[model samples]
Target: MKTKITLNKYLLVSLLLPVLLFSCKKFGDVNIDPTKSSNLNPVNQLVFTQLRFAGDVTINERTSIIMTMPMVQQISGAYYNRYGSTYIKNKQYMSELWEIGYPNDVLNIADAVERTQSDPLKTNLNAMCRIMKVYIFARMTDLYGDIPYSEAGKAYATGIVHPKFDAQKDIYDDFFKELKEAGNSLNTSKDAVGQELFYHGDISKWKKFANSLRLRLAMRLVKVDPEKAKAEVQDAYNSGLFTDNTDICKVDYNNITNGYAEIRGNGVSVGINQYVDDGRPRVCNTLINEMKQTNDPRLQYIARAYWTNPDRLSDRLDVTDQVKAQVGLLGVDAGHYNYDNFLGAINIDYPGRGTISVPNGGQKAQLADFLVRSDAPFFHLTYAEVEFLLAEATVRWNLNLGGNAKTLYEKGLEAACTQLSLFPNGPVLTSTQIQNFKQDNQLAPGKELQTIDNQIWVALLMNAPEAYANWRRTGYPALIPAITAESTTTTIPRRFEYPLSEREQNAANIEKALTALGGKDDWTGRVWWDKK
Candidate 1:
């Protein structure tokens, strides 16, 4: 009897152990405990991420967002120990957002999407997140012309170190399809869930955002398939899209202690050295003169007077005058004129702040002289931008907005003024300025498509990605190439070169992609929609 009892107890213990272990195990979802983390609240992080992305629209200014834009323009140059290769090679870093931000920041929503069981609680935000990924991934291919997509962001499980590039055409289709699905999934009736900085958990806003982006993507296909493009454009418009500045998505910066500040000072890649080396990117006369002609006051806000105090004794448009005088005429040794010193006359803050008592003593100048926090909301898409898009589209294909492209143009400029007013500096455009701007860029009946495209380019200043995309779609503005002694392709770089690592590590997969792509993986190969 005792032996039998003992055996029965042992059997019972064995049966229950698995249950206990399974119950005790942690798996499936990552629960974010707010009290334990030092990072900002989810609310703040979401907003900051958007700002960082938007601020990067200009290459080398705080944000590296427009790194690819300048690289394509051949305006890219080297200074200090740095070179243009960093910006040119940004395609490789596209995955960094997933590797770093996905698990760390955005995973809260991802987990919520995966693990939630309750109705209205199983986070629907995942689809929307994927919409953002569409932009990020599409941007990668937009720059590189072709890149791995289906296999991207899955390295941990697959052990696939390198992924093959996909044809730009297929990727474009996928982007459109994904965003369409994501937009459809934006049910405003669902419970407010996940981290949403731009919309504050507003599903309708997400729907609008998704649809607007779809229109932008559809417009990209205009050159390749006009019929399909028109169909998609109609679908986007019928979706009741974002029409006003209120629908415009942007990240408003907190007065103090935000992402821009942290990244501005704390980011290892940015700072005084970055400013001094790449600070030559300034407000060119093309933009400045246009604004000046309109009597636009925003010029003062955006561009501080470069030469606050040019040497009255010797002043010239180019830096060569200063360099020649400092080194040759002033009896300094050959090649002794540091480029950093040349920035001083332009009120450019160098490596450190304040006046350098000892001239040429090897102290770096403070770079506060460059573009810093104008303390404005970094734009994602604005009312002005959308109006311009519609205006150009109307002029090009005569798509349905009552054929009043002129009205859209006026609304766009008005919205532009309103958007500019949001900056801390008051009234960027005056009543007179607004009228003059309209008069100058107004499209006459039967105007060349190029005229509308050029005006759109003018409107997109500082919004680099949009400008670059617009340039690809319409090829307007006809920017003069850089005159510096640097060899370049006869045409602008159509797309980024595949990174060195992708070619070697994922050779088989890349070859498959090349075969699908008609046997050439050259950088100049146009994406499907780039038929123009």
Candidate 2:
């Protein structure tokens, strides 16, 4: 029964055993004219490091819901925090893609690809690198609508410094194709590639990740291109996508050597601390009220309750602006109700709302802590998410997608709860706790998709970019306007505004994209996929 496909894909590295002992060494430096060409390992190292950052920081844990404005520390500016300013910053981040970022990060994969071609047996590494590049760029295009894709990552030799933006629909189609080809090409027999970063060189796991990523992309296109989405999902399912444990494609971050903390820690690179509210980003009233109403146990794990004063609760009306201030002066450091005790809380000078403290670090610290060793897996794609995806797809089958969304939704929720338990002394919701959540939050008739998606959103907290993107695709959770919320943009930011740097440097190409996308390049304009 072990066909060539299964054998080549799954058992190759496992069967090879000793032959899989691959290592990177610093060989002789090739000194060319003037400049000495150091070992290529350094470039490879940078390629790996940047991939981790691209996934963790940019697309995943953005503060879509509970974000602050004019955040403490001058550099603590995270535009994803509030409404108006957030929109402006998104515009800034968008424009820089072609001019600054595309050259810097996305193009590095081409280097990886070139390097891999030299080692005939190690060709799989080249494929994996290209696959990861496609993943990162897909996220970029999804967030910002059209972006420099086909022409991106080519500034070094091509002299085509100004890359034009590709439409979102086109980008998604390319991503889906790239993922399928990459998944097929991940032959474990050739040699395990990429320094065991995410799965310790486990090609099977990597393959699973490729398929799962395909599934996610397929799910994304459901609203716009249902037939294509259905075909892709079925293809992945028939091809045996990720069906094992959630730990298969987990990313790693050691506490000191390399991890989210190292990047977020105070150092010269990071010139300020944006972790206001005692190193914990304060919870938005919108999310807090909703969770409280649902009696969701995930609340305790996601965020900690600030020390409540008996006086403040009763005198809600009498409380002046001064009354609600940072509690560091009150000796609130580490406890169940303090900032330090919060699961992902950081450490720095704590400032209250509307107040900005300029610490000597970047907003890295203030941003929510990412998954790492002993905390949880840096989840690539989870079995639970797949189940939810199936739930949605099945419903689209005239309720024939062949599964109950409710049962699958609960399973996914339970899996998330189980995954959260990996954290030290993480909260454990009892059977009664689970029952209470289900009983109170059941979906009304004909609203199964909405209900499943809402739960998915909650499970994906701290995983904001996924939630945000999925929200756009499905429009679930039905987020209401925040109280006193000031957003000139639509209810949800359809896509990021193009980065300002692109406007000045890559004016010609930028203008081409603008013209292609009608007269304006505003964040409010919807992508082709989001068309009504």
Candidate 3:
């Protein structure tokens, strides 16, 4: 049985409970508003944080879909893709993750952790909050490098109006410490953590998630600090890791077609599918060709071509016929002018090829309907990722992670394919198909790192932040930067520029961070763990 948690009415209540209970107070005063009761439930705050972490449309659209996805060459051709695919910098788009993440995700979880940490009855809740706090900060520090970590979200708590920017190394060191402490603290004998979103209050699953997340962060240090990476990876591996697909960490959103403010639906899905027919995302040739070369069984399930109606250009007909489907499964090449001339390139006549509607507006291969549904699950971390990381550790550091690299690599492949079923209406692979794919794609000798990282690229579909980070760290599935004259830079961006608001509001701290970034707030500057 699938171990997925769904959003419900109680979760909605949990979302609004804190807001109803607490009111804002002026800075330099006590954190709690004098008008309302000081008593705020940490469980409600935890639920709200978890929902917003996966449900922020601004972050999902600006960072994941537009910026990270195209930068990684997973999908392209949408108007917003220029920001990442063609390297055109947009301050608003680049800053969305930081602007939204700090106020919405980080603050809420930080508050929850603070509220529950000292309470004996809230031990499990506090542990979950701490784990979530680390998860939120990990993404922030990964994307923007040094950020307001030690004092972030403390404005209301400790009157820290302008927090200092903590270095990425310091932030990562704390992440390992927090994850370890939190994972060790989760106990079934303690609080039940009512209205839980991820695991439905399953203490064991939360423990595994903490370890899996720690392993991920540990592996990110492979280039910058190999010894530290090996030690952390081995420690996280031995402590415990996701054993199978059932332990995959994800948030299953309800089928609510609400706006960006609503946390009941999948934000990434809403962002991608919200675009009109002409503006919908098309699979990039990089991803399509990668799968095509390997005869990947997931291609059909993940991508599809649509037929536009001649009478009504906005109407799209799903190309269900197999023969025509093959001819229509064409992906847009990044930085090409094909975004405007979609029909001209794929105008071939097939047996079932219907008449083209707008001569210049043919449908390219887009994500499958089920994959983009508003109710689709947002994958936080997966068992496949843990397995792949283990495989990499074994190959790169020669660590005995309970199995050889080949065995772990195959298991990772299997888990990657199998985990798709967790999504609403997602594809389910047969045992035979899984085995055949594994057999056909054995890890190449002396190319194990590249091969494993390449599979990781495929496995991280839709989760673009992780995909972008892994590409930067491993440099696998070598990609050439888009060479168009309209591009903003000659290379892929290493990190997002700090928000302009940071300069205006917190000038000193932002300047200190920028000084560490070599006196410029630009994408070419690498994060601490991202070594040359």
> Model 1: per-residue lDDT, tens digit, 126-184?
55565666765655566556667766644433554576567777888888788888788
Question: How would you order the candidates by TM-score, starting with the best?
Answer: 3, 2, 1
Error of 2 at 113 (Å): 2.7
Model-by-model lDDT, in order?
A: 0.49, 0.50, 0.82
Segments of candidate 1 deviating more than 4 angstroms? 1-120, 157-164, 254-280, 289-301, 307-371, 445-448, 515-525
lDDT of candidate 3 over 340-450, digit per residue (tens): 554543343435655533333345677777777777888999999999999999998999787999989998999999988877678999999898898878888888999
**What's the lDDT for candidate 2?**
0.50
> By TM-score, is 2 or 3 better?
3
Clashes of 3: 0
Please list all clashing residue pairs in model 1, or write none if there are none. 349-366, 349-367, 350-365, 350-366, 350-367, 351-365, 351-366
Residue-level lDDT of model 2, residues 1-532, one tens digit each, is 1111222232223222212112223554344211112234422433343433323232222322222111111111222344322233344434433333354456555555555656767667766776777766765676667778887755543656777777777888888787778778877788754443555456777677777788788887877788988898887766566663544344432222222223221111121122333333333333444566777876544433232212111211211122223222111111012222333322333344333332222211222222221223345567768767777776676443335766666666666666665443446667787777777777567887887776676665444546667777787767543322344543445666676766877788778678645768876676666655
- Model 2 ranges with Cα > 4 A deviation: 1-39, 42-51, 54-80, 83-90, 93-100, 117-119, 254-273, 278-280, 307-377, 398-402, 430-432, 435-444, 483-487
Q: For each candidate, how many residue pairs have backbone atoms clashing (under 3 Å)?
A: 7, 15, 0
RMSD, every candidate, angstroms: 12.9, 10.9, 3.4
If both were scored by lDDT, which would come out higher, candidate 1 or candidate 3? 3
TM-score (all chains, Cα) for each model: 0.68, 0.71, 0.92
